[model samples]
Target: MINMKETINHYLAAWNEKTATAVKAAFQKCCTPDVTYTDRNAPTYTEEGGFVIKGIDLLTALVMGSHAKVPGRAFSLLTMPQYFDGHCHYSWGLHIPGQDEKAGWDYIVYNEQNLITRIVGFLPEQV
Candidate 1:
């Protein structure tokens, strides 16, 4: 089995990548070619699957956009990842200089080859 911590690091590397070429390479190394991804605040949805982005290309684009939207912030693990039955979840925080950190959770599914196949991200809602 692949080391879960290493896998999680690679996953975050894609999100923290500084350039388009590097981000694409980071994602291709850690995720399946046709991986699926969705987050709680995604605005668009499909009738069948809700808000989802399928394929590495689309995922790479999404991260690139994130880099544009929030430059200089980087994600860091706030807690160790927990894994079971091809699934893993972890808490993470976005480190923004002179600003409050944003905490979130990621639940990931891995394929038999140990590549990430799906990622479900969530942000806590205020009551």
Candidate 2:
């Protein structure tokens, strides 16, 4: 039985890490070495459709770049995470002043070892 809340928080914590080392460590804690991550609004896209990011190094770089772009941004869950089997779904938002913006949804798949194997993200509108 996976602790869904803890898993979701760890995933978000990876994105909110302030330093490269911290972000990398956070990712290592929650994700597998070959974890696949894709977001609808990602800058890099493939010919097959959708940008696919594989492995921890790339994942760390992605989050670090996001930090550089947004600086001091924090991601928080907008709804309780729902889990089924090895997968989970939840909505999240960026901490913007005076706004309760539900930015998007993330569907996560974890391995039996309790490491995240993949994440599929959907952002309807850019924040």
Candidate 3:
């Protein structure tokens, strides 16, 4: 059986890394070549309403661009992931060098091979 929690934690750690290159490497290691990622709050310029990203190459570019936009920002997990029925959910917070943290959560799905197949991230609703 796959170690669901460990897998999710690895993905989160990759996301929290300081550099985009690290993020890309992490994704390549943990996700399948055709993994799909959807970020609800992604800027409209790069994606549509769903912000769907298909393939590891495209996903790496997206993450690199995001990191370029905010050079010093990184993600930090706020709570342990909750897993049930083949899905995993966890909360996270964004850290910037001189700014307050922004929080969010991600829902992830994995394939039988223990690679992440899809991930959907949701930020707190704006006031």
Candidate 4:
């Protein structure tokens, strides 16, 4: 069984480490092929069979672009203490350079085998 907390931290730590390989590895370590995602206010949204994202490719693009913005951003879980209706809730408090502190819960939907298939969370506007 995968430790959800560890997995989440692993992904976030990659960004803080500023290693592109770590970032990509983090995604691979936690995400599933059917992974889907969504932002709070996206321009063009599409159904990823779960939370609405422009698309998986778009998610990748956005994440990739964020790396260059003053490296060392980290997402720390603030509080996430429940599991119901097949969705795990995780409240995160993040510290990112050039960006104000933002916090929100990520709704993770795990695949049948326990890999993260989709996640939806709130975030602030990026410059």
Candidate 5:
């Protein structure tokens, strides 16, 4: 079985680095090459109907673009991740310079190899 906590921490640490290279390295270390990542609140400029990234290359591009948009932003885990039946859920937030923190949760599915295969992000509904 996968060590959920370790995996989550590793992934979050990569995001906390706030760099495209760091994110890509993290994915290479803990995610499948064909990982699927979905952000419900992705900017309209991304893929149709928000963002749905498939494969590592596209995932890297998406993360790079995000980092470019908000330089100096940092990510932090707000709660311990929980896992059950190959699925994990965690809450996290982004700290952007001169802006209020933005929080969200991600539901992740892991493959049998203990690598993340899919992730779906959820954010609070906009008013």
Candidate 6:
């Protein structure tokens, strides 16, 4: 079980920086080597059943794909510290930095190894 608080913090920071490299690093740290980012129904590629960005190269591609969409977005702790048996899932109330309002909910699923396996995200709501 990993404390995602720190990981999420770095991710949100990297997003605002628009530094693709930083985001990539954070993702690599939190996710496994075979990490897959699901871009289901995303504006860019809602036609191909979403993209399965595998490995570091593809992970960076996925981050680049989302760069233009959710610029300056920051995540806020929502569900707090949660535990499920030995695994855990948590949600965050995302906010666009400088926007100062709740954007949407993003979920992160972590395994016993403290590596993220799934990432479920939604577009920001009216805020």
Go through the candidates in order and give the clash count of each: 0, 0, 0, 0, 0, 0
| lDDT (Cα) of model 1 | 0.80
- Each model's C-alpha lDDT? 0.80, 0.80, 0.74, 0.59, 0.76, 0.57
Candidate that would win on lDDT: 1
Candidate No. with top TM-score: 1
**Would you give me the overall lDDT of model 5?**
0.76
Estimate candidate 2's alpha-carbon lDDT, on a 0 to 1 scale. Answer: 0.80
lDDT of 1 by residue, 1-127 (tens): 3677778899898989888789889888889999999985443322233578888787877777666666687898889999878999999988776778889989999977678999999865520
**For residues 22-52, could you state the per-residue lDDT of candidate 4 as single tens digits?**
5556666666744777656433332233346
Cα lDDT, model 2, residue 78: 85
Tens-digit per-residue lDDT, 43-103, candidate 5: 5424435578788767777766666776787778898988888899999888879888888
Cα lDDT tens digits for candidate 2, 1-127? 2587787788899888888799888888888899999886456422334488888888887787777676677888888989878988999988754656547889999877668899999875755
Clashing pairs in 4: none
Better of 2 and 6 by lDDT: 2
Question: How do all the candidates rank in terms of lDDT, highest first?
Answer: 1, 2, 5, 3, 4, 6
Segments of candidate 5 deviating more than 4 angstroms: 43-50, 124-127
What alpha-carbon RMSD in Å does predicted model 1 have with respect to the real structure?
Answer: 3.4
Q: What is the TM-score of each candidate against the true structure?
A: 0.86, 0.85, 0.81, 0.67, 0.83, 0.64
Candidate 3's residue-wise lDDT over 36-95, tens digit each? Answer: 887764554254344788887777766666666777777877888887666888888887
